[model samples]
Structures are given as structure tokens and as C-alpha cells.
Target chain A: MAHHVRTDYGDSDPLFPSKAAVFWYAVLIAGLIAAPYLLESYYLSQLVFIMIYAIVGVALNILSGQAGQVSIGHAAFLAIGAYFTAVAQKYGLPLVLYLPLAGVFTGIAGYLVGLPALRLHGIYLAIATLAFAFIVEEIIARWESVTNGNEGLMLPPPSLFGLKLGTEGFYYLCLLVTVLVVLAAINIIRSSTGRSFMALRDSETAARSMGIDTARYKTTAFALSAGITGIAGALYAHKMSFISPEMFSLSVSIDFVMIIIIGGLVSLRGAVFGAIFMIMADPLLIILKDQLPLWADMVTHGLYLPDSVNQAVQAGVSRVVNAPGLKSLIFGIIIIVFIIYEPLGLDGRWQRVKAYFKQFPLARQRSARPPRMFLKSERR
Target chain B: MLDFTQQLISGVALGCVYGLIALGFVLIYKATEVVNFAQGEIMMLGAFMSVTFITTLGLNYWLSFLLCVIAMAILGAIMERLVLRPILGYPQFSIVMATIGLGLVIRALVGIIWGTDDLRIETPFTDGVFKIGALVIAWDALSIIVATILLCAALYAFFRFTRVGIAMQATSQNMLAAYYMGIPVKRMFSLIWSLSAMVACAAGILLAPITLIHANLGFLGIKAFPAAVLGGFGSIPGAVAGGITIGIVESLSGFYLPEGFKDVAAYVVLLAVLLWKPQGLFGLNAVKKV
Candidate 1:
């Protein structure tokens, strides 16, 4: 007990721990930069969509994950950013100039929402944001003078000093912006402000006791989060070349929340992971739906499958594949499953797997970390 | 004057239906401390079930209505036991998300089972109208009122007089104490869910003839949130009052305001109320434990 001990915790300090990690990370970045050249146009487009959603997902993570504030109306901000940029572009502002301006404009709107949100918490906050989203949608549809009403508005391809960017050029632009936003978010989450946010998330009273100004920080988080999402919206609108209120519905807001939850709540990296998962989810479901019948047929090949069984299987497969709300149904089930069983999400599972491999020689079969259990509220 | 009276009647009738749905929210929220986001979808499915039972299955209207209620109650019990019970101690946000997801799944399932197209369910009382002085109220509207009043009275009597009802109230008030007192707290929650679903089923049946059965009918649940909020989220009587208030407001606004204001009028009222008084008008201000 009295002997001198040498303890080393230096290995956990930085993101890139060793030279190998740095080199591999560099290689990854290089690959991303060169992706458009290697991949087909369709795949590249999917990547662009991923980057756009990733930006929104990261922004949402700041509010919901880091700050413990839930919003189901994030699409309203996206709509604002899209419409703001669209409107500005109509008045001759180039995409380059209007994009940042959209963020600022959306930030102001978020701040206004945050002001009222200060009075609310949890479920009340959620309902208020939802109502706000509905109101925004109504305004967008009814206020035809500005939004062009339900017919929606179209924009010219994004240009910089009269140079129009093609699909590949736009992909690089989205990639570059997403990278910058990611870097900025990492920086923000590491700063004192970020810690304060986490503190507020864990316990408002405790954070207050620590002399953190909960009110100012909460609204600032909202402003910053909304601003980033606004930028994503601007990118989305430009990418689509057309925008409508219908595109950003309550479901989109729910999708953002799902992204953070599935990505691993309270982790920056999880945001990106979630974006990739979300972007690819619909296609994955389609593939699954298509394959189910093939699998079923294979299983029943050696046996005498009745006409009724065949008809039933066909009907079920068609429902899965072609049902109008199949995507939503799948998304809902995923949310429920993830929240109940795998609350730590994919990112959490990834960490555990990594730890298991790293500790392989001396590792015990059982995980040291206990599964997250439901925390009954202590309040009487 | 006649137009005004007529709007008032329709508004009252609509508000009662909303109140009925709002009551579902109140009941579940009171017992479980979780809002059933699928309340509207439950209503939509109930309407679809009744329509199928009557039109497709060739059952009498009354029998179909009764069967639909039973089915919905069973559905509610299954949902509470299977889906919601596992994550009882999770944060409120996760539970809310689960409910939202549940709503989506239910809506989608309803669409797959019953085609996406809207279907009219004709009831015995759809063709008639009653003239009371200057007001020419449709029989359907009057029936909605009658059904809602009967439901409210039944709920009140059940809560006040029945042992099971008192046990449910006790459970909501203090789960631990109720558990200690030999009450099955979990069973109470299951019963509350079923009861709430049954009321919503009744609302759906009454609402079917007027609105027609459609998947989009679930959106009515969203509007009813304001009614629940306006009434004080926890109080059943407050829910009814809030529903009436919202109904009157929506009716009057639709008549007087610019088009589209009617859809969002309840939210405006709700926001104003939340801003001024965080606790709903009838909701008791819960003291925070420091």
C-alpha cells in the first residue's frame, strides 16, 4: 500500500491516440475527398444527402443530446432556413452570401422560441415546439406573398460569382461545409459552454449551484443549434432546387430526434453515424422487403406450399414493400426498439465491442458496465 | 342569428368529441404520467373497426359499436402490458418518443389493413335534424352531445361509486401507497388505458358519420392536446371544460377570422395559457421538492 505507483492515463487524452490512428484518419479524409471521382452519381448524391442530414443531426444533438432539451419541431427551422435563402436569392443574393444569412436569420427565430421555452420543460417544451411547427407550416401555406403558398418555390442552381456548380461540384461543396460544421461542433462541445450544457442536462439545480447561468446557456444552445440546422436547410433547398412546406413536416422533426437517439445520444460522432443510418434506412427496408419473399420461397421450395399460403405471403410482402407508410412504420418500430432495449444506441454498442477486442487476452466474458436500467424519479 | 346558433351547436358537438379524446389523454396521463400520443390513431382504428364490423361483416350498428369498444379495450391492455410496461422507469422524453413511434406504427398498420381511401360509415341518425327554436341542429350533432354526456356521467359514477374506480384514483395519487395498501397498481394502469381507449372508441363512432373514416383522422389527437392542456392536464372535469372552450373558440374563429385561423386557434389559446399560467386553469400547481 505504501509503495510508489506509476499510473498512465495519457493514452485517453486525444482523438488520434497514436501515429497509426492519425495516418488512418488522414487516409479516411483523403478517401472522402476523392469519393465523388470514384463513386457513381447516384451514390455520390446519397453521400451529399448524408452530409446534409448529418449537419442537422449534429445541430439537433447539441440541443437534445447535450442540453437535454427535446424539440419535435426542428423542421420549422429547416423550413425557415430554406425559405429565407430562397427569398434572399430571389432578390439577387448569391448562394454563398445567403447561406450564412439564413443561419443568422434562423438563429434569431430560435432565440425567440428559446425565450418562451425557458418557462417550459420536458413534455411541455415538446408540445410548444410542435405547435410552433404547425403554426409555421400554416403561415408558409397561407402567406403566399412570401412563400409562394402551397405551389412552392424553385431556385436556380447554386452559383458563386456567376459560376454554377454541377452535381459533383455541389457534392464537394456540401462535403466541405459539413466538415467545417463538424469541426466547429467538436470545438463547441469541448469548450466551457459545452460542459455547462451537459451539466444543465444532467441536473438544472446542480448546474445552478455550480454558478452556471442556465438560462443564457440554454438559449445560446438553441440559437447555435438552430443556426447550424438552418445552414443544413439552405443546403437542402439548394440541392433539391425546389422547396415546399410539405417537405419539412412533423415527421422530419421526429426523424432528427431518432437520428440522435439511434446514433448514440450525447456523442458528436453518433450524429454522423445516425445520419448515415437514417439516409440508408429506407433503401435498406426496401431491400429487406424484397428479400423476404425470396427467403420465404426458398424455405418452402422442398414442401408443398398451398395456394392460400402463397397468396398470404405475397400479400404480406406487398404490404411491407409498397405500403404508403411503411417507412414511417419501420422508423417508429426502430425508435421503440432502440429506446427500450438498446438505449445506448449503435455508438454505445460500438464502444463495447472495441473495448472487448482491446482487452481480449485478459477480458472476462461479462461486461463490467451494467445495462442501463430505468431510473425511477426520486421525487415523492 | 340562425347561422350563429347553428355554428354554436356544431361547435359544442365537435368540442364534446374533442373532449372525449382529451379525456383519454387525461386518464392515461393521470395514472401513468405518460401521454398516449397514439390517442387519435386509436380513435381512427376504432372507427375503422366499427365500419368494418357494420358494413363488411354485416353486423347490426349497435352490435358493431359494442364489439369495436371491446376490441379497443383489449388493444389498449395489450399495448400497455407489452410495449409500454418494459420502459416504465425511463425518462419522460423516451416514453413520449415511444408513444409517437407507436402512433406512427398504428397509423401505418391501420392504412395497410383498411385501404388509404376515406370511407363513409352511414349511421341510423345521419339523415335527421332537430329544430329547437332558431337552432336547426343535426341529429348527429345532438347524438354526439347525448353520447358524450352519458359517457361523462358514467365515468363520474364509476369513479365515485365503484371500488375499482376508487382504487384507480388512489393508485394515481400515490402508486407506492396504493401498492402498500394491497391495490394492484399495474392492473389499475391497464384498466385506465382500456377505459381511455373505450371513451376514444365511442368518440370515433360518433365522429365517423360526420368526418368519414380516414387515416388522417388521427390528427384530431394533436388538436385535443390543447384541450387537455387548457383543462389542466390532470383533471377530467377540466378536460371537458377545456374541450368546450376550444370547441367554442374554433367554431367562432372559423366564422369570424380569416380562413385557416380556425385550425390553429386552439394552439394560440394554449400558448397564451401556458405563458401566463404554467399550470392549466384547473390543474393544481405541483410543488417542486428541492
Candidate 2:
């Protein structure tokens, strides 16, 4: 569509040839390397979580944004990875070997799920994936012998070469893996397979006409997506130091979806920004909940309001602000709002902001280009 | 033999409840091509509203049910006009995500208003049980079966005789053709949504007596999804048949098999159906034109 237009120089290239782009990368890498030492343990842990989510989001971007397949049951792959890692560790496998094993196993499972997905269309694929997630949860809960049922399984801290990896060590491990995943994702998107995926996503008929084996590419995309998500899951399990089927519920799957959408529809940069936004949103909501009442009091000062009216206002504000569901309610509302207003998500908005600066002298009332419609078939 | 018959009766009753919900799924999918993920939440809201009307407001059960159905219709209409109408031409995923967002909003709203308590509504036939030969059935289950038959007949007659109903049928088949023939297609969407919401409410009211009227009850919508898919995604009759089949299978498996087989049995049946006949038992297989 219109949004996919290449206005910037070297827009289609995988490598950043511009000095400015390389400089930004250097700054970002240096910041990441110094983050653990500069930030507190809690903030470092949050960064680790963001990195994990970014890895999964990038993988999902490959399948959904590039490949045109959507999955609402991605948490299943995460669950599989977590459980397989836990079980494999118990069987005396080292952390190094079991983690990759979890990825491979999850990839195989993803391939199998993709087989049925091959025949299914949009809504049907969504339903099947949803069902697959539920079935996986059921198995985890009931197969007590293997999954330890609803009681959940406790995981030991991972060790490499007989040295126990604590929170700081784990953060490094996660960061390293995330960087590798990002590199792989960039390379994959530049490959022929990635082109086939984009073609299928844009138009199945056109992709088929071009002699692309749509079925094989679709399944392969799923396998790769699940494999990366599985790696994230394994890292997540080690990071949390505790695991349960409850951890990978449907909401978790929905959270991954919000990541890609909020980050940006089809851009890798969008995935990173989306993950960072998703992780930071929780504390942001809490901060708002706490500050809204103070702000309300400040706004309504100097009025000798009746006690009953004051009480009512205060109680109502507190209820609205403090409800547990408010976080999710706001998230749900944001998803709808973004889909309607900003289909390009945070990345799209950022691009507009950059364009504004570039065209500052001649900027008009309707300066930013109208967002391209997300649907390819409906594109003008 | 007695146990088998008892399970069969109960399964039929549960199947009827599922069928009621499945009818709503089929209706929305037929008209909009978007599966309203918030359907279960809609059903749950109906039950909660009926409970408030009956207990908190001190109204008769029938009156409370009627008021709840009307409220649900309005809610459905409002949802369509406000949330769904804006992104009409977008891909199916957009609509589906919007409905999911709606479901989240509805669920949280219900939790805030009603509290998460497991409140039970008292129905007229709460303690009644009928014994016929070697089989015994609860009055709640029996009423559900009766309600299903009556509702199905009413829907059948509505489609066959009513002008709006016929227009809805035509709209589902081909929206452009119906518009050319002078049907108000957009209004038909609101009507279809209201009708679907009303059907979901009926299912909720029927089920409230048998289960706890809590926030988690919206999960039944997910269970009923397999039923709709089993019969065929598009066909009304298929949804009913699929619902009944899933209900019986779940009932029997829960009793005869291991502790948790009941939960996954519906999905297993669904996978089998998808593998063998993806269109469902009654759905027409669509041919792709390239």
C-alpha cells in the first residue's frame, strides 16, 4: 500500500549504509552494554523482559506482518518451550543444550499446527489456533505426570560451565540471544523466503502466479516463528525461576499481539518499540492510577463542596482508578483506538514526526501523509 | 444403562444451551463475516442483567428476562454503530480484534458493576426433577430443551415468512445484489447483531439456573465455538447439530473417560471435523476463483 512506499535512500536494503544509521546503532548497542551496570536490578530485570518480548515480537512479525498469517495462540509455543526446557533440565541436560532443544521441539510442533493452518482461511485459522492453545493448556493441566499439572513446576537457576547465572548473568544471556534473533530476522526478511512471505501476505493469487510454493512457505514461516517464540519461552522460564500453565494463558497471547500492532504493523523497528511500550505500559498505568486523584483534587481546589458531593467524587474516581480490570480495559481500548486511528502504530507515528521536522519550513495544516490503509486488496 | 440414559438426557439439555449460543455465532458470521469474539461476554451480561432485575429490583422472572433481552438488543445495536461501523471495509482481522477488545471491555465492566461473586438466580423450577422410566432429568435441563425447540421454530418461521428476515437472508448471500434490490444493508447489520445478541441472552438466561452466574461463565462461548465449527461455520442447522453432538460427547467423556477429557473432547472432535470436512457438516464448500 501507500505506506510501503520507499522514500528514504537505501530503504529496501538490509544493511544500513548511511553513517547516521550506523551511528544510531552504535549508540544503542553501547547503551545496552552499559545498561546493567548503570540501572538498578529491578530496571535491569524489566529490560530483560523487554528483550524477551522483542525477540518474540520480531519472530511474530516475520509470520504475521511479512507472511500475512495471524495467530492468537502464540503463547502455546511459549508454553511448549518453557515446559520442554524444564523437563529436559530435569533429565540432566545442561542449559546450553536444552534451550536449543526446546526451540527445535517447538518448531516441530509449529510445523504440525501449520499443516492444518495450510487449508484454513483467516477466521478458521484463528479458531484452529485458539483451539490449539486451549488444548495445549488442557494437556499441561491434566498430564500431571509430565507437566506437574496446575501446581506448576519450579525451575532451578541456569548454570553455564558450572557457574550459576543469577539475574545479571541471565540478563546478558537474554540480551545476547535477542541480538542474534534480530540479526537473523533482518537477514531472513532480506532473503527469497521472506519475499515469498510478503507476496503471499499481499496476495495469494499473485504469489501463486509467480511460482511461489505458498503452502511450504506458510508452514516454514510458522516453524520459524514458533522456534523463536520457543527460545523466548525458555529464556522467560529461566528468568522467572518459576513456571506454570497459568503463565501462558490466552491473555499472554493477546499481549504478544498488542506488541506487534502497537510497535508497528510490518517493521522490525516497530517490534522493538512495541515490546518496549508494552513492558513500560504497566508501570505507566499504575503511575496514572496513583496521580489522577491528586490531580483531581488540585483541579477542584478552593470550592467548599458539600461533604456528600466530595465523598461521591472521591469514591468514584478511586474506583475507576484502582480497579484491577482498568489496566486491561485501557489496553483493550488502546488496541481498538490504534487499529482505527493509527494503523501504522508507533513506528508510523514516529515516521510522521520525522517527516514534520524534515518539512518544517513548508509544513501545512495537513502536513503528514494520510495513513495508508492496512488492507492490500483495498489499496487505491 | 440408567447412567447412559441419564447422561444422554443431560447432554441433550446442555447441547440445547450450546445450540442457542451457536445460533448467535452463525447469525453474526453469516451477516458480517466477522466472528464476534465478545459473544460469550454478551451472553454473560444478559444473565447478570436478568439477575439484577429479578433480585435487586424485585421483579418477576419472565418480566426480568424480557427486560434483559431488550437491554441486550440495545447494547448490541450500540456496539455495532459505535465500535464496528467505523472500520467496516478493513480486513476481517480488524473486525475480529475490535470484537475482542469489546469483549475485554464488557467483561471488565461487568466485573466492576456486578462484583465477581458467584451469585445464583432463583428460577421457578429450581427444585423440580422428572423421572420417566429409568431416566431422571432436572427441570432446568428439560426447560432448556423445550426452549430450544420453540426458539428454533420461531426463527424458522421468521426467515420463511417475514420480509425483513428474507432481506437478511439475501444480504448474507450477496450484499451488493440485496442493495441493488433496495435493501437497507447497513440497518440489516444492526438488526442481525441485535438478533444474535437476543439469542445469546436466551442461552444465558437458560443457563444461569444450572451454573454460577460469574464472570468466568463467558468461557462457555469458547466451548460453544467448537459446536458451531463442528456443524459448519455458515449453516444455522449445522450449528445446532454440532452443538448437540459436542454436548453429548463432552457429557459422556466427562463421565466415562479420565478427569479432564471432557474439556479437550470438543476440540478433538473439532480437529477431526476440520481434517475431514473443513466446511463443517452442513457448510457449503466455497470454490476459490483465481
TM-score of each: 0.95, 0.95
Instruction: Give the lowest summed-lDDT range of ten residues in model 1 chain A.
Output: A1-10
Deviating ranges (above 4 Å) for candidate 2: A1-12, A299-304, A363-380
Scoring each candidate complex against the real one, what DockQ results? 0.61, 0.46
lDDT string for model 1 (A178-249, tens) is 988988887788778988999988888788889999999889988999999999999999889999989988
Clashing residue pairs in candidate 2 are none
lDDT of 2 by residue, B1-290 (tens): 89988898888888888888889999988877778888999999999998899889999999988999999999899988888877776767767888888888888888878878898898887989998876778999999999988889999998889999999999888777788999998899999999999999999999999988998888888888889998787888888888999999999999999888898898888887887888788888785555
Query: lDDT, candidate 1, residue A73?
Result: 90
Worst 10 residues of 1 chain B by lDDT: B281-290
Candidate 2, residue B20: Cα displacement in angstroms equals: 1.6
- Global lDDT for candidate 1? 0.87
For model 1 the local lDDT of residue A276 reads 93
TM-score of chain A of each: 0.93, 0.93
Kindly state the fnat score of candidate 2: 0.39
